[model samples]
Target chain A: MEQWKKQWTPLLPERVAEILERLPDDAPLLEIRLRCDRPLELVFDGSDRIVYGNNKAPIVEENELKALLRRLTGYSAFAWENERKSGFITVGGCRVGLSGRMIRTEDGVLGFSTVSGVCIRIVREVKDCAKPLLPYLLCGGRFRSVLLVSPPGCGKTTLLRDMIRIASDGLYGAVPCRVGVADERFELSGDANGAIAFDLGTRTDVISGISKSDAAVRIVSTLSPGILAMDELNDANDAKAVSEARGKGVAVFATAHGADGKDLRLRPAIGALLDAHVFERIALLEGVGRLTSVTDGDGLRVDAVSQ
Target chain B: MKTIGIALLFALCCLAGVRLGAKKAAPLKMIRAMRAGLQSFSDRTASGATLADAAEPADDAFRERLSVYLESLSQGSAQADAAGRASAAFGASDAVRSGAELFFCGLSDAPRAELQRRIEAFGAVLARAEVDAENESKQARVLRSAGFLVGTGLAVLLL
Candidate 1:
């Protein structure tokens, strides 16, 4: 079976799974969206289609969605409580984003009261995706701090994962060094039952199922990594952690949600890192593993500079 | 030869009474084992283990009884199917069996607090059942003794 089918099919209704299994082997299936009383939607490469059952659109019930959530979490909501708070569950490197009623208190949001919709993002590893930009990222045989910025569904995580693998494995003439991965949601590590599904290279040390800041600190202090890699640098705390690690001479490899560097500067958290020149290079992705441009710390195009 | 035949008849009656007595007490033992196993399952799951990983029995007896269910769950069998298999493997009374069926069916369908509450509630039910079974077993013991005595009396009269 394909990776996506093996990882995701069991988490869906049987009817839906049947429909998904019928898809061609080469289908570029991207996302599977399930909404209560709505037709099942399959997002392919740059397109989407509503699936039907018995000649009519398959309407999912609220109970089915809940059951699916239960199955995805291996029937232990408590085990996945942290992921629930984040409104997503990471399974085998694929993220299942959830939409539901928020349970809030005077303190803050507690968790979901009910899940109404689910979106499973399909993630596939593309080896050597970062090979093109490795030259700019490495200078004088030392890895430079690079932050990948892209819009949602543009493959930032995929690219970041490959870069980590290559960096840790010493691929393409890059010297192999210790890389510590703070896989807060288990996305980078694909950890299931304490076993890692992804090949993050033998030299990589991944600390998962914990907060990024805590994991980063623990990884740095204990693992003594030469490169510290993390995903989704969204908040000030994350930026602070990355900055602190960089200050300690660990090269930071991270990804963030933004259209480009300009969009990134609008966010005060990441903007602070940019202003402090925390990252030596910023790669803006156009699409899946496709980099539109690479810029230096001062926002100058590295390709242009080389020319 | 007649005396030996009479002795064999009395022994058979005593064996029958003992077997009946054990049958009457089986449910209590089964329920006790289930309660202990469920408690372990609840604690392990609360500590972030998956259903299959946490489905450990408290002792050897329950472990042997739950082997089929555990194997099924670990192999990714549907929750309902696994629970069914467990229910079939348990040769307890109807009431105890039904209660266990409810627990296994709902195991994977609720939040932690809800699940914990349900387990406690089921445990209480089992506790009450154990008391009832003890009282029934006491009655069964008397009946079993009387049955043995009555059968011996009949054999002696026949001789």
Candidate 2:
């Protein structure tokens, strides 16, 4: 109840709050998605259930969606102008995706003019989720650069986040390092105050609200981090940044939306990096829990029982 | 001596009535000031200033009142919404109050195009308010002038 109260209560309106309060403390809620003037639903266990619509539930007005957006953004549309153009904003330590017409100038996207839909993704910190991956991620008393491979929604981001925390905190007799996390989307850290909104451990530096490749290069040059972590690398720019960091001898822990390590080898730029042996260990995330397999730099699976 | 004292008193009373008449005839001047404040706000906004900074009026008195309204917004109390805040800016008329509120709210976080539209709408409302005030002032002037003439006649008769 406290967990639910801490995460959601202050954000919901009175009517929505009342309805959510009626449910049990453990609701197994994944998301609360809304498209303007459309039905509101709760995403749990990969199913969409109506959030508020019964004889008891209060009917929502069209303006309610608009009101929610203002509240979530703290009524500062000016500050979030860039994020709106990108079609999302991270608020209340959760990710809120927006969709609408694009606003662009000669330079690039400015922001959204009108937001019509919102998708709220609820993120929770799972303690010790990376416990099993530690041995494969470390070798000969040194941290090995790891790349997590998984398709979308396979929970790769969550796993990488925990691993960063574990590395920063030096859990399970491992050495602690000055870890740098480039959370480009503000998704992994949910920070606005120049500090991480989540528990990234004492030695972790989380920088967000910037382009992915640029952030990576900036952290590598300026932060002097012992290790680097990033979420969801795509395209040649990201591959180049990863190679740059690896050249600087900063072990990189990152995630990519790929089903398997060999699968990623077909993509030209990424395949080039793989061929160059940039990654020492690869963990391919399965549906929701433990990784399906952890492969070494040679693209060979390692035995869990071995040293 | 007593006769002279009575005559002097009558003259003083007549002068007071004339002064009242002059005060009543003064036109509603605030309408122009309000329009000017909005113009300054727009200029500031265009220069890439935040709404709070842009809405900071050039007039010292208006700036003080706006600060109070801003403080209330930051505190996020139900007691003071945008409408309540704008009430302190213009006349007590609901039209003026609502228009001011709409203008202020637009300045808070609106896009540039939206802000421009609200500003224009507010300007129109302000113009109407100016006309209304002018009409009222004209009627007040007529009443005060009539009072002055009547007082003069009464004083003349007394003397």
Candidate 3:
């Protein structure tokens, strides 16, 4: 079993862990969600199952859920205040989503007064997954500024991560470059037990725990990276940062939450990027790790084979 | 031989008094260590260390209890329940037990500023208790000297 998968077992209640451990090592588990007094949900690659105890679905007690949160935060909630406010905490490269009674004040969201639900999303490195898309993403033997468009949970981040690794490592006839990753959520370059969770290639420099714009500007000024990789360009600041970096002669590999070019243009920030033709290639993803098609910045179809 | 036995008895009484005095003074020392420990813990937590990592610099007794609490947390026990169990280690003092329980409550989820504020508030409580402990320690010293004088008087009367 992958170490990341094993990390979840210890955080779960004993009975749930026992039930989960019964699955095969390669069970393709995608998520483990726990709700207070509700049945445990296990999401696999293509299916979801509810685990039962005795005759009915095992219930997650309130205390058990809180304890799980404590363990996830390493029993130091003060340290993860920002992440808690963001409604998620990353542990061992797995993004644990939290939901509960949010305490709000005049300033904004204070934090969770009581966490009632937790969703642990399992993430694994799909090595060389970007190999086939490399040809289309490259132009004239040089990497193009590409934007990966996908719906939620459609593996846009995973593909973008693999693409960054491939470009940084210069593997399989790809151009090598110093890649600066603006990991706003720490999801791109997660840490597990004080160690880097994923192999992002030797040339990748990651800046996390800051906004994408600040990290991008800092990376460009300090590291002078040839390529900048960031996940989820959602706001104007992100789009402007990517545009500014591109203008400065740095190629960008970014992912956006959208299904196609139409979806991309529907959002104000993404539409501006599309209008400016910042990205030379726009790759659309359907299903997990499957590229459906590729289009140019002008919305013209780029004939390419899906990997 | 009888005189020597009387001297031995008087010496034993003085020794008992010294031991009792030391016991009375122990709380003051313990509280001082706890204050220092909490400062260190705050520093470590500010630097993004887990409670287990920060617990090493705590007072010996509190560290052991905190270890148990952390172990209970790892075993999936609720924060309140774990703190309840850990606070039982301060069996001799209800004030200390309650203070410890409050210290452990919701600490895992407290923000950095809130944590610092809590520590300062707890430090105030500890400061007051420290004053009380210091007074008790002084009283204990007086009690010990009185016991020694009483022992001497009894021995002289016997002579």
- Candidate 3: deviation at residue A205, Å? 2.0
Local error of candidate 3 at residue A221 (angstroms): 2.5
* Deviating ranges (above 4 Å) for candidate 3: A50-61, A139-142, A193-195, A303-307, B1-25, B56-62, B76-80, B90-93, B109-114, B135-159
Preferred candidate (DockQ higher): 1 or 2: 1
Candidate 2 lDDT by residue in tens digits, A1-307? 7474566756665566676677676776767777665556777755557765565343444466666776676554565666777788877557788876777889998777677777777777777888888878776545789889887666677778888888888877568888988888877786645567778888888778788888888999999998899888788998999999999999999888788876898788778878888998888887765589988888999865323
Query: Candidate 2 on B1-159: residue-level lDDT in tens?
Result: 856775666666667766765554443566667777777876776764455566665454345545655566555533237547655566536787887777666344576677678878988987888788777677766766666676667667767
- Model 2: CA > 4 A from native: A13-15, A55-61, A103-110, A262-269, A305-307, B1-84, B87-103, B112-159
Task: List the candidate 1 regions with Cα displacement exceeding 4 Å.
Answer: A18-22, A49-64, A304-307, B56-98, B101-105, B131-159
Q: How much TM-score does chain B earn in each model?
A: 0.75, 0.73, 0.88
Please list the Cα RMSD from the true structure of every candidate, rounded to 1 decimal place.
4.3, 7.5, 3.9
Candidate 2: how large is its RMSD?
A: 7.5
True-structure RMSD for candidate 3: 3.9
Tell me the whole-model lDDT of each prediction, alpha carbons only. 0.81, 0.72, 0.83
Error of 3 at A111 (Å): 3.0
Candidate 1 C-alpha lDDT tens digits along A1-307: 7878877777688778888899987798889999987889998877889976566755688867877887787766767776887899887778899998979889877789889999999888777877887877877556789999988888888888888888889887677889999998888888767777788888999998888888999998899999999999978789889998999999999999999888999999999999999999999997666789989889998862210
Clashing pairs in 1: none
Q: For residue B9, what is the lDDT in candidate 3?
A: 76
| Per-candidate iRMSD | 2.8, 3.7, 1.3
Q: Is candidate 1 or candidate 3 better by lDDT?
A: 3
Global fold similarity of model 1 (TM-score):
0.84
Evaluated against the true structure, the overall lDDT of model 2 is 0.72
